[model samples]
Structure formats: structure tokens, C-alpha cells
Target: MTNPSTLPDFDHPPGTDLWVFAYGSLMWNPGFPFVEKREGLLRGYHRGFCIYSHQHRGTPERPGAVLGLDRGGACRGMVFRVEAAAVPDVLRYLWQREMAYRVYIPRRLRVRTDQGDVRALTFTADPAHSQYCGRLGLDGTASLIRQGVGQSGRNVDYLSSLIDHLAELGIEDQGLRELAARI
Candidate 1:
């Protein structure tokens, strides 16, 4: 993967807004300011517990799993509208937070929203990355979550929060729900 530092800055023209696609933690804690938000759908990708987190959620010795936009299916998420002037700072922050080890590939993905279809900045799982754990069975996933704890908090907390947020949105993720129950 290319260095995130070398990626283009997410700058918007004077009158344009920066739309961001949030499929994971960003849905609950964006950290940056956004003017508007709406339920959105991103096609050609589905949220999966595919990344082996060795920092924020666990250690290298016993990595925790985190969500990633894996290819196939569709993902129902939130799209945030960021002010143009804040794009630079927000992009910087996102790079630092999400690209600690370049486990994701930054891209402009088409998101379907009430406002219409628009391209938004999205971070997708890098399947070739060392941290990519790919597909895991519910029991295995739960086992990892049960043993994971990192700088941020427990892995179960992360999985539970995502499941809870999806429930609040009326979106069902059966696999995750099953795993959550096992944990």
C-alpha cells in the first residue's frame, strides 16, 4: 500500500462539502465536526470483522478483530457532510487514526443516500495486509473478542457497540449478532 502521507488531501472547493462514509467506529465517534448526516448505503462492499487489530484493540500476541469493508454484498452506514474548510484537518486526523499501519485502502466510493448518490471518502480493508484476518467463524471470532484488549478498550466492547448501533439503525447483521451472543 502507498504511504498515507502521500495521498492527496481531501480538500473541497469553496462551495463544496466533504462527504465521508462511516461504516465502523466513525458512525459512533467521528471525532471531527460534520454539518449533516444520513443513513446511507455503499454497494460492492460489506462490513466484516476482518482486520486483526494489534494496537487500538489488541496486541500482536493476541490480536483483536475489527470491522472492514470487505468486497461483496452491501453495507448500510452513515454519511457525514463535513465543512470544506475543515477537510484538511479532518483528513489529517483520519490518516493518523486509520493509517497507523496502512491496513486499509482509502478510496472514493459511491454512497446512496436520501440526498442522492455521491462519492464519499471510504476506508476499505486491505486483504493483502498483514493484519487482514479475512473470514472467521462465529465461534472463532467470539473467542478472539473474548481475549482481546488494547489501548482503546476491550474487543467485545467494540463488537457490542457496533451491533448495538446497527440495531438502533434497524440494520441486521446476523453474523455479527451471532458472534456478539457467543461473546
Candidate 2:
């Protein structure tokens, strides 16, 4: 469990648009409204199944894997630009959805898009967090995905959903595909 005080605060003035990067479930189902969205590439971090999901996709006893933006490499994902007025509601929703375990630390990083560069808010795994698994071997990851079920449903379904969404975005992740096939 993470202390609420540890969560990062999003304090932005009114009338300032905010950009958010979505690499996992948010890629498919962003509950918040946004004015614009674009495919973005974030360097210095890669999306990997490096966190043990003990709430949404599994229990503590049988944890499933969830995607996290870990150090190194790069990630291709969707970037959403929310109008300033909508930022508050979006932050509230994201906090409830992604900050539960505090496994992810909210961050503002630069993302490259066709329109140019923008600083976007994103989540990266807290390597020190108890749920952080760093990088797990493919087989071990597959086993967890095969057995996990939680509030959001089957862990395998989550993985499948991510894979499907990636494909739809014209993003090819061989590592994720291999992990999915390994099971």
C-alpha cells in the first residue's frame, strides 16, 4: 500500500492544456475526455510488464503483470491533449484508476509526435515499490498472465487487449507478441 501523501500532485493553472501518454489499457479505454490525440514516441522509457498487479488484474496471492514505463529504450503510444478545464476531472479519474497501488509514479516527460514535441504526463514503475518486478523472464510472465484474475477480469484478457490495441495503432511489439504466444 502506498501512502496518499506520496502521490505526485498535478498543479496546473486554468486554461493550460495537458498532455497524457497512454501505453496500456488507457490506450484503448481512456475514460476522460480529450480535445486531441496523436501517436507519440517517448524515448528513455519502454513499456514492459514489470509490475505485479494485485488489484485490477489480480490479487496479491496470484498477481498478474501490468505494463509500466521503465527506464531505457523507447515506447510508442497514444498521447492525449486535454483542455485546461478538463484537466481536473481527468487527473481525478487517473488518480483513482492508476494510483491505487502507487506502483507507478506520475511523471512529465517529453514525447515526440508528428506535430512536434510536447511534455506529457505518464506513469513509470517505481522500481522500489514492492510490486515492481523489474524485468521478468518470458515464461514466468506468461505463467502469471495465465493464472491471474481480478476486478478487471482475466489477466490474459488484459494482455490480449493490449496486444490488440497495439496492432490497431500500427504498433508492432515483438516482445509482447512472443510473450502472448509463449503461453
Q: Write the per-residue lDDT of candidate 2 for residues 1-183, one digit (tens) a residue.
A: 443334675444457999999998798799999999999999999888889988778898999888888898999999999998888778878888888767888888899999999998898989999898766788988988898899989989988888888998899877789989987
- The sequence of per-residue lDDT tens digits that candidate 1 reaches over residues 112-166 is 9988997898999988898887766667777788988999999999888888888
Tell me which residue pairs clash in candidate 1. none
- What TM-score do all the candidates reach, one by one? 0.87, 0.89
lDDT of 2: 0.86
Q: After superposition, which runs of candidate 2 have C-alpha atoms over 4 Å from their true positions?
A: 1-14
Candidate of highest TM-score: 2
